[model samples]
Target: MNKLIAIMNRVLSLFCISLSSILVACVIWQVFSRYVLNSPSTSTDEIARFLFIWVGLMGAAYTLGQKRHLAIDLLAMKLENQPGKQAALKLIINLISAVFTTVIMVYGGGALMLKTLATGQISPALGIEMGIIYAAIPLSGCFMSIYLLKDLLDNLTDISSSGTSTL
Candidate 1:
């Protein structure tokens, strides 16, 4: 499982880097075309925007997988000496994160993606189905949920092994 997660993280990192490069190149092209050529490229703006969205979402998932997402951690720090409390707090946090990511992002994003697909709407400049662009939402959500589940399992294992009394 850890190996799978590591591979996924690496893939996501590469994906984000590629998207970032694409976005930068597109923006540069757009600027050069508008200022130097005196004609703005119609497709570059839209393409860059879509790439930016994907990079942002994927980068967030990658960060979460790395366990680098922001957290107060004041309570956690305070509870450091209390193994059971620390484990319980970690479990609760992971549970909440998993539910939010799964319900709001994963399930909701999936429904939205399907509806957009059925509507057959296409981007004006790119001429691609809008649903394809929106797919980043659910894909990132799944990645985040996977990380949350792994964290939850680790916390549970810690609780079991600590042999400390329950909170």
Candidate 2:
């Protein structure tokens, strides 16, 4: 499992880096074309927007995977002395995250994607199918789900091994 997550982290890292590079290049080209050439490229702006969406979503998932996502840990801090409570709290948090991500992002976003695809909706500037762009939502959701599962399992293991009374 660790190996799989490590590999996923590496892949997502590279994918995000590559997408960021492309996004930067697109913005630069757009600026150059608009100002220097006095003829803005129509496609670059739309391409950059789509790329930004994917990058932002995937980057968020990657951040969560790294355990660097922001948290309001005041309660956690107050429970500093209680490892068992901390573990339980973390487990509950993971469970909640999993449910939300699965239902909203994965299931709902997937339906949206399919509906757009079925309707043959296409972007004006890029002439690409919008479903392809919408795919980022569910894909990122899957990434988040995997990371949450790993966290949930780890917390369960901690609670069990601690041999402390269950909350």
| 114: Cα error in model 2, Å | 0.6
- Compute each candidate's TM-score over C-alphas: 0.94, 0.97
User: Weakest 10 consecutive residues, lDDT, candidate 1?
Assistant: 158-167
- The segments of candidate 2 whose C-alpha lies over 4 angstroms from its true place after superposition are 165-167
Residue 82 in candidate 1, Cα distance off native in Å: 1.9
Tens digits of per-residue lDDT, candidate 1, 10-63, equal 999999999999999999999999999999999999999999999999999999
The residue pairs that clash in candidate 1, if any, are: none
Query: How does residue 116 of candidate 2 score in lDDT?
Result: 97
Residue-level lDDT tens digits of model 2 in 25-112: 9999999999999999999999999999999999999999999999999988887799998888888889999998899999999999
